[model samples]
Target: MNDKLTRFLFEDRAVRGEVVQLQGSYQSVLESYHYPKPIAQLLGELMAAASLLTATLKFKGEVSLQIQSEGAVKYAVINGTHDQRLRGVARWDEGLQELPTEFSSLFKKGVLAITLAPKDKERYQGVVALDKDSLAACLENYFLQSEQLLTKVYLATSLDSAPKAAGMLLQIVPPTSETYQGGDNKDFEHLAMFADTTKSNELLELNPEVLIHRLFNEEDIRLFETQDVLFECDCSKARSAQALQNVAKTELLTMIDEDGDIKMDCQFCHQQYVFDAVDIENIHNDNFDAFNSDGRIDERTLKH
Candidate 1:
């Protein structure tokens, strides 16, 4: 099935939920690299989680889920935008033969960082230790510690032939009244119980509507319009050029002199951007004016 993210609200209870199923997008991410089974599955789950979290953004921006560790899996991150475009990449230690399935074993001392970068505002970030066995639990802990909201996350992935990922999120809406005594606990608990029972296979195989209906048939659910999610890397030659501008001009020139050209590869999409001597000269002369004020390269100046 095509990738999609769906949001639903409980009319009778003060709660909100989101469900996302990823297939084509998940496969697109894995196609760029030959990841191990455990790492691939972890990346898929991170992608699904990033999509679900990105849907919750109230502004035009992107949300990134990053895990940094000192274990075999050094770094893994997934980026998702408000529009649902997603991309991810991971790096691991060389000469590592076996990767453990547990989070603690994979990341002996790691931190899970969630960053929210808005298009027109300051960015916000939160970090939590990866003490839990599962990414879902670690994210839940993040919500509890950072937002102080009762949140539950369920993530699943299938790394077989056709890779896929699915995730569900439920958060309790805070009480508006000052005198309201936390009566929504029971309601949130009731819904979370059902969501927890979701099976990995079911989540990967079933559609959003069917899955929701099967899980929360008794609740009055207001399903919103589905949003399409796809794997799209935002990297471009212009961005790469701008990055080159950040380096010392002498360094870039030296690289061009030694290698005949400077080649930069995007880790997420594996797209290579090559900068020849002429391109480097243009970048230095124009002082990056080859790019417009909007940060996009001018069509006339682009060579590749």
Candidate 2:
């Protein structure tokens, strides 16, 4: 199944919205990683929320919505590109509960940090205390405090759908010069309060058109063309080699001597990059780029 992300604009007022649904796309991320129920659910929610956030960005780059904590579940992160390509993973302690219903049960005390990075521009980050009852609530507050604009986010996921993570967001766009408030922003305030009543079922199960219509029937809404979202990870052995260059030759050579190989992993996709003695020598030697263990480097790949 193809993944879908849609954005909507309100014709009558200064507000916008987005709705996303993942079916096969969500399940695909789960195939290689075996996560506990709570982590899986956390990943699903993060994936859905990230997709919505990525679409709402007014710039050209991507957004990383990371959830880190000091409790048993130390970290849970989801990174999503502006093109809708998403990939993420989590780390946690064992003997945890198999089933988790409340969002707080996953992490006793965590912080949701959001960093906005554009390809050719400066990066900006905002931190939100996980003091709220739910992740969505915390993000809503983040929008209010950071942007000073009203925003609401709703996300949901299920394994029964086998790999789909879907979610929706509704927010008021800051007023344009022409629409600047004079006395009171009664209309914008009403819209934001209305969005607070959005149900999880509507966010998870409804079609984009039907969902928005149900929520904003009194206002005129404009829908944008839908875009495709993908589960793509930008990782390669060459990129791995670049990172290795920063390590000391003596240390890497010693690791190879002990384990007979140098192995590395990509935290985002959990991809393993293994390098043996010959591989380690190449990195330290002058001809690091010229030598390759037989059949190790795929010859046809393009460099990043």
Candidates' lDDT values, in order?
0.85, 0.74
Give one digit per residue, the lDDT tens place, for model 1 in 16-104. 99999999999989888899988998899999999989988889998999999999889999989999999998888767878888767
* Pairs of residues clashing in candidate 1: none
List the lowest-lDDT window of 10 residues for candidate 2.
Answer: 295-304
What CA root-mean-square deviation does each model show from the true structure? 3.9, 5.4
lDDT of 2: 0.74
TM-score to true structure, per model: 0.92, 0.84
Q: Which digits, one per residue and each the tens of the lDDT, describe model 2 over residues 176-249?
A: 63442333466667776777677766766778788878888888889999989888877666566656766787
> At residue 88, what lDDT does model 2 achieve?
74
Q: What is the TM-score (0 to 1) of candidate 2? A: 0.84
- Give candidate 2's error at residue 257 in angstroms: 4.0
Give the candidate number with the greatest TM-score.
1
